[model samples]
Target: MSRLEENILRGLNLIGYNGPLLQKTQLPVAIEGGPKNVEYTQLVNFLTNEIRTLLAIDEEVNAVTSPEDSVAFVMEITSFLKELNCPYTALTDGLVSDRLQNVSDRLLLLDYLITELMGARILQEKKPEKKIELKLQETPEGADMRLILQTLRFPKPPPNISITTLFQKLCPTIPIVLNKAGADIVGEGIFKGFLSEKQWEILGGIQKDLYHEYKIREGNVIDTIGRYHTIFSDRTKGKNELFEKIYHDKRKLLKVEPEIDMADLIAARTDLAIIEKTSNSSVRKNTRSQLQKVIIGQVPDRGGRTSEIAPPSPRNAPMATTVLWWRKRRIYTWGREYGWRSSIQRWL
Candidate 1:
């Protein structure tokens, strides 16, 4: 027999020697009236035995009840095929060949089945990766929780892991929190009116604080909430002071200098809405000063430089005007006489 036929016969024997006997049943078909030579008989025997061998391998793999047994059968078939040289035709035919061919076929039947099995086994028998399990205990008042449990009886990971593949599998399950500066961050108007009354009160305080600190670098209402708003308005003016108190002392660790990045800070403020929208209303010049006095009177100057500007005493108002008149202050310019009248009459 040729080397190829000899190897085929040996592969057939690996399953059981019953394959050659089964091929004998179909021997008469090869021995037709046309073939009357020794070469024809040899050809018939080779064809019959080879066909039977393939059939037997297919039956053993397909009918095998246990997965482990099926795996073993396939591995042996593939090994034999590989020994005969990997023939791609065997896969297209009724059987499998090439080393690991049967195992590969079984794996292809199910998505990620073979990969999971190998990963699980390697994780158990060897140290491949760091596997940690998180367990949350049950509480009577809380909802029931079900968690998948896996036991990895191993040590540290080997540094040979493929980083490109590792992160692809690990990243999806990790949770992330987006920016909390409300609808402005997302550029949507839907969440604007949803703030509670308490939130508005807190937001008002933040707006005022940001105006004082970063007015040179203006911000919007959204930034007011995110950058300046405080949970406790009375304890301090804004959240910036709180952040400063916590991290300012650790300036070296945080890498923050007294000189601020005015542009970025301003952008954050504008995005958060610390600055109010400008109104187009025109105020009468006389009424405007009076309104300013009323507003300035109501606003409490808490430790700021403006607190030192004491308003004129009730008795000093007349004396102050007399002193200004004695000095002949420019009180009756041509514009002043008509300015108040024109302003009152809604003329300018």
Candidate 2:
């Protein structure tokens, strides 16, 4: 393909457009004052020239010297122009008014962006370039003269890293794995509307930096909980003050009976209400007796302030009733001791 066609294909690739370009579709190209339907190759050819002339881009040199550069230039221009009114555009005059508005609309953002794309080395060809360092080579035969092309290598961008690769860097010897979807979710900071900027930064740092097997400690757990909405620390050290407020609110809620569920109780009568009625004295008496048993049974629970336990039984403590067997020996020993004491007291 010619340089123009090659550059056009490259542009298509860069934009991720898989649609047909070679087909003779209504491309809508150059007309009397502007653009309309034209052949695919013709459309691109016209577009290439119009962009070059309009943007003052030198297609012969630094701007579009190579197909790769041409593609990058074309892609950037197309994307930028798609937002503005074009000179040879087939779009309606109304669209032109809405987008381009006038002639100056063509230069919308081309000024600064053109300069950035011009010398972008990553967009250059991947193949090594040949540069001649010396005109002659020192050979076995005194000096051998030859045209030289030495391969000059430039560093390429690193390949995309996956979560597995990141995990390997973070924990080399461990068998732990991270949930890719969860990692992405947490990294995005959109889920639960909770994760903080610092939390996302810390997570991204772990992906890039080598880290040992780590756990969330008190100090850092607070940071995690503060930054992340999901990973909660019940005992956060106040980094997540909002959650701490929530924790307190939840504790307060536990003490409050649900008002919504109790709404139906407006029509309900209490046992005390029924017991106080004069004609329902039998039920009242039974209820009183039952209430006494319930109160007695609940004594071990200390009125529900603490957990329940079996009430202590007197029958369970056999040693409390067993006595007097050792009293006879105690009395005999006391008598013998007192016999000596009586004689000693008389001398005193």
Give the TM-scores of the predictions, in the order they appear.
0.16, 0.16
How many clashes show up per model?
A: 14, 5
For each candidate, the alpha-carbon lDDT, in order, equals 0.40, 0.39
lDDT comparing candidate 2 with the true structure: 0.39
Summarize candidate 2's per-residue lDDT along 275-322 as a digit string, tens digits.
Answer: 355548775666566535533555453375435666769775665445
Which runs of model 2 end up more than 4 angstroms from their true locations? 18-20, 23-34, 39-348
Deviating ranges (above 4 Å) for candidate 1: 1-6, 20-235, 240-348
